[model samples]
Target: MLKILKYLKKSSISVVAIVLLLMVQALCDISLPDYTSKIVNIGIQQGGIENAVPEVIKEDDLKKLMIFIDANKQSQVKDYYHLIKYKDTESDSYKKNIDKYPALKNENLYVLKDIDKDELKDLNELLSKSEMALLTIENNKNQDNKIKESILKSFPIELSVKMKDKSLIEIMEYLPKEKTNAIKKEIMKKIEKMPDSIIEQSAIIYVNKEYKSIGIDMDRLQNKSILKSGTQMIAIAILSMFVTIIVTFLAAKVAAKLGKTLRTDVYEKVMSFSNEEMKKYSTASLITRSTNDIQQIQVMMVMILRFIFYAPMMAVMGIFKVVNTNVSMTWIIGVAVLFIVFLLSILFTFVMPKFKLVQKLVDRLNLVSREIITGIMPIRAFSNQEYEEKRFEEANRNLTKVNIFVNRIMSFMMPSMILVMNLIGILIVYKGTYSIDSGTMQVGDMMAFIQYTMQIIMSFLVIAMMSVMIPRASVSASRICEIIETNPTIKDSLDIKTFNPDKKGVVEFKNVSFKYPDAEEEVLSDISFIANPGETTAFIGSTGSGKSTLVNLIPRFFDATKGQILVDGTDIRDVKQFELREKIGYVPQKGILFTGTIASNLRYGNRNATDDEIKEAADIAQASEFINSKPEGVEFKIAQGGTNVSGGQKQRLSIARAIAKNPEIYIFDDSFSALDLKTDAALRKELKRKTSESTVLIVAQRISTILHAEQIIVLDEGKIIGKGTHEELLKTCEIYKQIALSQLSKEELGNE
Candidate 1:
């Protein structure tokens, strides 16, 4: 996977943008739970009161609260609230506040002035503790003697007994200033020990009663708080969704563009391979690398862009939110994460090895399938269909077995993760119930903690899924890289040399020896020959006599190993492969055609060829008979590989394609084996007349194919044993004489 990183440089800008958008999405997702906490804690439970600091209080209630407040803090608290007397109700300021606080018509009110968040927070803390102390003393005044004893212990015993039946405010009026201050100090000490949340809850109850007294609508306040938070949640969700869509779109585009580029480069690389390189990689493997392997990487790229980057961001942010929400339940998330990591580690150990095998199995399956399809006729002719079926089934079953095993292992992931999540949720709620009952945590905070914990676990799940995909995609990336990175065994020299224009149509091999890349011995050894313009040079030998290999070297299909093969006095290797092949027309042993019309296949030789030139070439190769007989003539559609046509017709068309090229040299590599004696003789006669100015090289098994050639070379094993025209070879070369006698009668030889 890392090997393909350079290819991703073109998409760097989009990738960076995706990263930024993923951060935004993570932030939005992390924020939603906080709003839920606010709605539950403040909106529903506190009657929409966010803090313990009352916005408005009756003047008498404010004085009652001030009794418990510290002397230093009382002045600051009083400074934040202004008195509005009933007499002032007629003024503009009082009139403006009257509708909000309708009880202003009967009593003087103390309304809070504008304050910053820091000051408001300080005031809330100060007032929350004071209000809790007042509420505690008042509620305890009516309780049993034991509870009242704890509160009355601050006063004298006789004084406390008389004050037991009085209200807390009345008791305070009976005590001296020093005694009252001492009692208030003791009450504040007890309230300070209580949790901040409990203190705030108690204070909010008192504030709610004050709001009721001031004619403030509590229902409207609660509804507005809920609605505002809900709207913000919805907006953030939509924005996160929008960012997610853009990220997915950009990821897919980058992956698809990379896939296209890889396919094209793989194809061009394969096309440039010499025969040696072709033998290094099988056709089926190359197909899998270009198509299936590349597809795997493309899919993985999208996952990488979406999950790889986003999952970590979410995980980190979620952890931060979890820590900030409540530290008590964080252990549940920690245990859950450790268990998941262990599960993923075990899975990785077992599954990583199989990913490599799966790609190889796919190659095997494709190879068997392609061989069976291409050789179906031969298999049917030999009555071996059952054997081939068994071969195909073996490959298919192996692939299926590996895939099922891998899938079965992967299928365990989601349910196991869900089980962990469920168990973790149970543990958090069980643990959180105590905190809530003890007044250390609220319902809203616990709920938010659960969500944040889940988000953290979900991030790990995304990473686990990608971990499984990465190994397979990594294998695929390596396979694809093999094709793109390979250097062909045959390449043009860095200091390229052009052909000698004055010596056109001349091919020479001086002590040229050749061997396959993997072979031990040379297929052609110490071979020397020259075929000049306006002459035909032909090679004939028994099977495996280096006939085809000898002719193949002239086109530089495989460079000569021991000696030089030159064209027009210029070494073939020194010139570019394209320029070398352009001057020679080559016809392989098998007649191959693409899926197109006859005109198109013929035009492939020379795209600029005119209709008259095409007709003349077809007529010379004896292909015009079958071509003109068709309803569409030259426009007749040719099936792939020309399978619709007979062997003889395909061969004739192949020859016609080469002839249409009108090159300096023509190579017929046993290309006429399917033609009959009559057509062969006629085609040869026409070829001799038309190609009289071009050198021709032919490889043949039958002696009649090369009988009329100007020069004939007979190869035995890897050596040339004879060279001459037909009559001279029969008189001088025993192998040539024996080959001729076996194919033709003495009377025919004499007549020739």
Candidate 2:
């Protein structure tokens, strides 16, 4: 998978954009839980009173709070509050305050002034502690002896007894300033030791009472806070969703573009491969690499773009939020993550090996299916349809069994993850209930912790899913890279040579020995031959005598193993393959045609060939009769491989395509075997006239097909046993005479 990412260089800008968008998406996702916590903790549980520092407090209430506040901090707190008198209705600020806080109409109120977040936070901390201390002392006045003892431990013995009778504020009023300051300092120390959450809750309770006294609508305040937080949550959600859509679109585009680029590179690489390379990789395997294997990489690319970066960011951010929300519950997330890793580790052990096998099985199934489809006629003729069915079934069943096994293992992952997630949720809530009851954790904070835990777990889940896909895609990437990285066995020389204009239409093979790759013995050895312009050179041999192999050398499908083959006075290896093949028109042992109109197939040899040229070539190949029979004529559609046409007609069309090329050399490699004698005779006779100025090479099985050739080479094994015209070879070459005798009578040979 990493190997394939180099193709994404073209899409680097889009990938960067996707990364940025994924970060935004992660931020939004991680923030939502924090908002939910605020809504629950502040908006509902605290009646929308966010902190210990009240926005507006009655002047008398403010004085009560000041009694508990330290002298040094009291001046700073008073500086942030403005005294609004009920009689100051003429003032614009008093008018606004009276309308907002109606309690201003009854008494003077102290409204908090604007301050920076740091200052506000300091004020909130100080006031929250002071409010809690004051409330504790007042509550202790009527409590039982045990409760009073715990509350009064920090106070002096005389003050502790006085705290049980006189209210805290009255006792503070009577005491000297030095003594009262000392008592306040002691109470502050005790309050400082208390949990910050408990202090904030206690402060908000006092703030709620202050608001009620000031004629503030408590329900409206709570509703407004909830609505504002809910709106922000919805907006973040929509924004995250929008970012997700764009990320998905960009990721898909990058993956699809990469797929297209890979397919093209693989196809072009395969096209450049020599026959030796073709033999190294089977046709079915190449097909899979081009399509299914590439598809696997494409899917993995999207996942990598979507989750590879995003998952880790989410996991880290979620962990940070979890830690900040409450540290105690973080253990639940750690254990859940460990278990998830263990689960995935077990899955990988069982499933990774199978992924590689699945791709091979797909190749096997495709190979079997292609063979059965292409050979259906042969199978039916041999009455072996059932045997072929079993072969296909075996391939299919093997593939299916592996797929099911892999799927079963993967199927176990999601439910198990969900189970772990649910169990973790239960444990968090169960553990959180104790913290909440103990006044250490708030409801909102616990809820947010649960959400963050789930988010963190889900991030691991995404990584786990990608872990499975990455191994499979890595296998696919290796296969694709094999094709893309392979250097063709046959390549043009760096110092390329061009053909000599004076030596056009000349082909020479000097001591040419050929063998298939990895073969021990040469198929053709020490062969030497030359075919000049305006001449016909024919090869006749038994089935394995290297006749077709000899002609195939002219086009350089496979380079000669032990000798040099040259065309137009230049070594074929020194010239580009395209330039080498362009001068020759070759029709293989079997006729092959692509899916297109008949005219298009004919023009395939020379795309610039005119309609008249097409018809003329067809006429020369003796195919005009059948072509004119169809209503579409030259426009008649040809199925792939010309399967829609008869064998003879397909061969004639193949011959016509070669004729349409009108090249300097023509190779007819048993291309006439499918035709009847009459058509073959007529085509050869016309071909002689049409190619009178060009060189022609023929590999034939029938003696009648090459009896009139200018030169005939007869091969007994890989060696050329006879070379001469028919009449000359019949007299001098015993092997030629016997082959001629087998195909024709003595009178026929004498006549030729």
Candidate 3:
């Protein structure tokens, strides 16, 4: 994972922005719970108001309260004094004013009590006759009053008089305990029996005057709070969504660019590889590494960007909220998160090693599939289709089984997470309900706790999900790194020098020996030869006699293991491979072509070739005849590997491609093997004239192919048994005589 991070260094600024945005998004999410708590605790239960003044009080009680209210400079103290100052003859006017200031009811009660006993009797008789109506008032405060100012005010003024006259211990003695107790009981009973209608009228009057005086509406304040919080939540949600979309797009772009860079790097590395390096990783495996393996890394990169940073930040912020909630239930979240972590750790431990095997299996599947497609004709001819099918099915089944196992294990994750989340919710509700009953926590607070707990759990859940992908992506990253890190065994030296000789196209092998990697014996041994400029040198041998290997060394496809190969009389190793190859045109045993028009393939080695040069090279290689037969001619599209063309046609086009380069040295490694006798003779005849001033090295199996060469070398079992012209070799060399007699009549050899 850390190795992969190096590639992301260029995207650091964007990454930091994504993280900051994610943190902002998390903070917004956390704040929602607080708003929800407010709506529940203050909005629904408390009716959106916090403080209310009393609507009714007794005259003596009001006077006592005024003492404290005066000290505090409370505006309501004037209302209290009004209630006490107006009584008796003004009681009816006060009753009329009670609707506006019902707090004066205490003064009316004092007036009723101080009335002449006979007059009080008459008033009681008038109330019993139901002639008077009850005054009504209402209080709108949401909060219950903690300080009972009404009760404090209702205490007897005589208690204060007694306390001022004597010490606290002597107060009861001076006042007479029996009289004080009787008066308190009687007054409390009368206050408790106050009519609901009268109290409601008083409360309404008190609230209206207070609100009018303060110049504020209680309902508006509550509405604004709810609206403000709701608006903030919506704005944050939209911002979070916007950030998510932008981050997703940026992450995808970064992953794609990373994949592109990696693929180009791998391709450049493979292009520079020699035969030994190519052998280290097969063609099919290299294809998988550059494509499927890199795709895995790309996918992992997206997940890392989208979730890896976001999850941890969310989790940290969630933990912060939980700690600040000031509750013991926070430990419940910790335990739940730890359990999730343990579950994921166990699953990843079992699955990570298998991810490496999965890529290898894919490589094998590709190898089998490619071979089956390329060798379909041969498989049918040999009646081996069933064997191939069984082979492919077995590999497919192995890959499928592993994928199923991994998928099955991962399927348990979502369900387990849900279960853990629900269990935590149940536990919180159990504890929260008790707290609510005890008045320690509110419904809104409990709801907020549940949401925060889920947030904390989900953070770990995101990490758990990523655990599955990281392992697979890590395996793919390692595979891609392998190709990039591989140092090609063959490379030009830092002090590479240019090769210049008096005569060009002179290729010489000086006591050269060669062996394939891990082979027990050399394929070619102690070979010494020179093909001078303006000459054609041909090699003929039984299969595996190093005919192709010997020529392959000239272009530095592989360097000589035991000796030196010289091009233009300078050691080829001293020159850069690209510079050395530019001087030679090589046609392989298998004629390969890319997906393009014939003209494009021909121009591959020399892009500056003119149309005339393309036609001239095609005519010399005898490919012009077939090419002109097609309506598109040289513009005809060739399928990859030239699969659309016949073997002989492909060979002709390969020869034409080489000829287009017009190199000083030309090598034909069994290039004529696919051609018939007539076409082969025509091509060689034309090539001989065209390359008269250049060196030509030909590897052939047929004696007719090399009959007129300036020199013919006969090889057997990695060693040269004969070297001379055909006529001289027939007379002196037995190996040459055997090969020549097999393909020609004795009279034919004599004629030559």
Candidate 4:
């Protein structure tokens, strides 16, 4: 995890920003439980109804609130009865003061609808009844006072205190308090001081205010607790989600980048090695390292981004929370966790070695699959479908058998974890009963703790799940690293100078010797030879005679261990490998081709090769015939590895690729083995004419193949048995004489 983090730190700003986002998200998530505690203790416990809200809803502005609707109609009727009598007296006074003519303000006039005095009195009686019910509910002294204030604010003070217009909420806020008694006395005095006629004839305005969250009454113990807990959990969940996404994305990006970088490094290292060195590791193993191993590492990185911090934090915090409960049940859970770890650890320990064997088996299976596909033509020609199938089945069966066993072992982990959890759950329930009886635990507290315990156990289970992949991926990483760290036996010169490839070709071997790594004897011993401008020097020998190995050195595919190889009088090593290789055109024994058009293959040697140059090269290599047969000509698409083309066509195309380079020296290591005699003869004729100014080296099995060469070298077991013209070799060297007699007619050998 640390290593992955360090890699991500290479892009510090982005990583840090994402990490911050994750932290913020986690903060939100953690806030949930804490908020739950608040809701339970404060909102529900206190019965803050005005602020109370449902669990699913979110409103914070709500405070103590109530809505009182109706007023006391009975009190209004009694007041109306008195007001009629007072109004008669007021009317008499008005008549007496008519001469004074005092004007009435609109505020003092009646705002109520006109009604018969008897009907107005009846409505007042209903209003008084409604007010009594409201006041009756809030009969507490404190409540009455608040109700009195609610009415004063909701209505005109004249309407509320005088009982002219009333509100149920105002009555609801009414508390039976000492202050209520004093306020009521003062209100009665003010009402009496006003004429009763004014209260009976006039109406007043009042307002009712409502709060949605507060309306639900979260102040109740159960409701408030649930609301607050839910809010906190929601906040926590949001934070967790935010943190998870940020971390997972960042970790995945970093892991992918590292994988790509590691891939590049591995490729460079492997590419630096010669053919012999490349043969040391199988292709499947290399692929697994690049893809499978990298993916495993990538997954680990993703998890670390999301849960690395969370896993440990949850484990530790859960432990603390659980332990603080101080219930006797702690030991049971601890033992269960320990047993689970031990069981899983043991299971993994036994399976790890078998998993490695599975990887090897998979490599073998891939090798077989590759061979069957590559050698499809041979397999079909030999009618070996069943034979190859059996081989493939054998290899595949070995892999499947081991993989099944691995799956079987792995399959046990989750169930075993669950089983352990269940057993521990039983113990917890049993122990929880005792704690409850002893007052060491509450029902809700035990419920929450049990939930937390499950979370802790699951986290460990997840860790165990991830641990299973570690050993296999570790092996793969080591394998990949090993390749990347290896120093190639062939290395580029540190101090290289520019060189030209246009000079007259004169390649010389000065007692060159080379031994493959881990081999007891040198493959080529004391090989000293020269091929000058406008000449062909061909090597002919039996199998294992170092023919191809000898030509390989001239190109520096592998450096000679004991001697110097020079080109144009300068040591080839000092000339720079690219320049040295650019001067020599080589065609290996097996023609290699990638999936592409004919024109693309021809351009492999020189990207800048023109159409005319490609045509000319194709003509010289005898590839023009097959290429012209296709309707698309140079645009003809080839299958992967040249599978679509005939063996001879593939060889011709390979030759054309080298020919397109038009290098100073051309090396053909039995590149013509697949061609027919007529095509071979035509190709040689074309090559000889086209390469009149270039040196050519050929490694062949047939004497007829190199019969017309200016010089021939024969090898027997890595030593030069003879070096002369073809005729001279048939007479001078016994090994060459045997090879000549085996491949040539008497007439051909007689001239030799």
Best by TM-score: 2
Better of 1 and 4 by TM-score: 1
Q: Residues 1-752, candidate 3, lDDT per residue (tens digit)? A: 66777887777787788777767767777778887776765555433432223223354433333322223343423422333344544656555655544444333322222345565444333222111111110121211121122322344776554344342223323444565455334433443465433333333334344444433454675676567667776887787788788888888888888888889989999998998988889999999999999999888888888889888887888788777664667889978988898889888887777788889999999999999999999999999999999999998999998888877778887888899999999999998888676555668778988888898899889988887888788888888888888898788978887777684788888999999888889999999988987889999988888899889888888888898888887898898888888998889999999999999999988999999999999999899988999999999999978888999889888999999999999999999999999999999999999899999999999998999999898889889889989888988899889888889899987886
Estimate, for each residue in 425-481, the C-alpha lDDT of model 1 and write its tens digit: 999899899999999899999999899999999999998889889989999999888
Which residues of candidate 2, in runs, are more than 4 Å off?
Answer: 143-167
Q: Which stretches of candidate 1 lie over 4 Å from their true place?
A: 79-85, 143-167, 170-177
Please give the RMSD to the true structure for each candidate, in Å.
Answer: 2.7, 3.0, 11.3, 14.5
* Candidate 3 error regions (>4 Å): 46-219
- List lDDT for all candidates, in order: 0.90, 0.90, 0.75, 0.68
For each candidate, give its TM-score against the true structure. 0.94, 0.96, 0.80, 0.72
The best-first sequence of candidates by TM-score reads 2, 1, 3, 4
Instruction: Give lDDT: candidate 3, residue 324.
Output: 68
Provide the clashing-pair count of each candidate structure. Answer: 0, 0, 7, 40
Residue 100, candidate 1: C-alpha displacement in angstroms? 2.1
lDDT of 4 by residue, 274-330 (tens): 776678777766776666766766666666555655655666666776776544667
Clashing pairs in 3: 57-106, 61-153, 136-200, 136-201, 137-200, 137-201, 138-204
